[model samples]
Target: MVIVGSTNPAKLEPVRRVFAEVFGGLEVRGVEVPSGVRVQPIGYEETFTGAHNRAKGALRTPGASWGLGLEAGVEFNDLGAWLFNVAVVLREDGRTGVARGGSVLLPPAVGERVRAGEELGPVMDELVGQKDTKKGPGAVGILTLARVERVEFWRHTLELALPPFLRPELYPLE
Candidate 1:
């Protein structure tokens, strides 16, 4: 398994867990990859694009069997606050499968404040009735209180999702 992007421990550890649990016998490794595009706190389209771009790049590397990309960012729905979403994309045999994960919703008022350019932390502090250091840890950060790191979350999502995409013959008729 090739994890496309940074080798930061927080990012890599989750990627490893997904490989171990899902693929069972495959080698899991992390390598820094270039997306050729960077957007701070990525949004939906960019996040997916970034992930796809990374997977393509990782595959070009010598000796790679599979490539994974995890990209997370904030996006606004009709409610208008910056909500969190993560994109996980995998490439093997020149084919790709992608899944997106996110928190259901953030407090609506908080989004309005974020739209005015305040950071998510300050807004979350008010919305959750907490104060200080609220949004500082992990991807899907405040939504999950830093538990299960985003990297791992994305990896697990992709890992569990693959069998269905690859082995549809096993599924019962709809």
Candidate 2:
């Protein structure tokens, strides 16, 4: 069984799809867990930390054979602000694999608000005039006009992180 740290459908569904394909016949469940970081993680470090913490928290789920944590954050650079997601998978034996999702440059308006202190979810909701955008298509989806939903965006990250688990001989556990 696999326990996902967040109950958001965007995060939950993708993990379920990927795990079913990678480790056939396994069960995936989403459990709400605090990221233990800022509501809007600022940069790569904070985002990765949030994901790592979630994976650790997932260990508490009863009968969980593996834990999956997905976190998205924004980084402001000279050009503009870019949004990216990190995926972390933790196995019972202490092995872990991490991969990052593709990033998209946020428009100036959204980027400025995120830089100031607002969470991306709310900013995106207002921009899209929707209620809970985070639970469905996220910033990437709205910005891309639904060309990429959150599940598809996250699926790429989860798949990238699976190579290590699939070929343990190539990626030896320390």
Candidate 3:
């Protein structure tokens, strides 16, 4: 069984698809667990920490074979603030795999809002005049105009994270 940290369908569906593809017939569940970080993690350290914490928290649940955590946040580089996604998976034996998805520069307006303490989901929802877009296409889909959906972003991250889990000999459980 796999336990995902967030109950948000956006975070859960991709994992379900990826888990089924790699580990057939496994049961997957999304549990609303705390990330133990800011509601809007601003940079890589906090975002990655949130993902790691969620994975550890999910592992606490009885019968959980694996814990999955997904986090999206923005990092400011010389050019601008770019949004990125991170996926972390933790197995029962304490093995972990992590991967990052593609990142897109947030428009100046959106970055300003995010820097000023607005959550990306609400910011995107307001800009696009849509309700709960985060649960659907999300900021990546909206920013990319559906070229890539949020689930797709997670899908790519999952694909990157799965290799180590799939090839335990190569990864060596270190």
| TM agreement with the true structure for every prediction | 0.67, 0.98, 0.97
CA shift of 147, model 2, Å? 1.2
Per-residue lDDT for 24-126 in model 3, tens only? Answer: 9999998878998888898889999999889888888889999999999888867877899888999999889998888999999898888888888899899
Task: State model 3's lDDT.
Answer: 0.89
Question: Which consecutive 10 residues in model 3 have the weakest lDDT in total?
Answer: 165-174
lDDT of predicted model 2: 0.91
Say what the RMSD of model 3 is: 0.9
Q: For candidate 2, report its TM-score.
A: 0.98
Task: Report, for every candidate in turn, its global Cα lDDT versus the true structure.
Answer: 0.59, 0.91, 0.89
Cα lDDT tens digits, model 2, 121-170, are 99999987899999888999999988988899999999998888998889
Best by lDDT: 2
Q: Count steric clashes of candidate 1.
A: 1
For candidate 1, what is the TM-score?
Answer: 0.67
- lDDT, ranked from best to worst: 2, 3, 1
Residue 145, candidate 3: how far off, in angstroms? 1.6
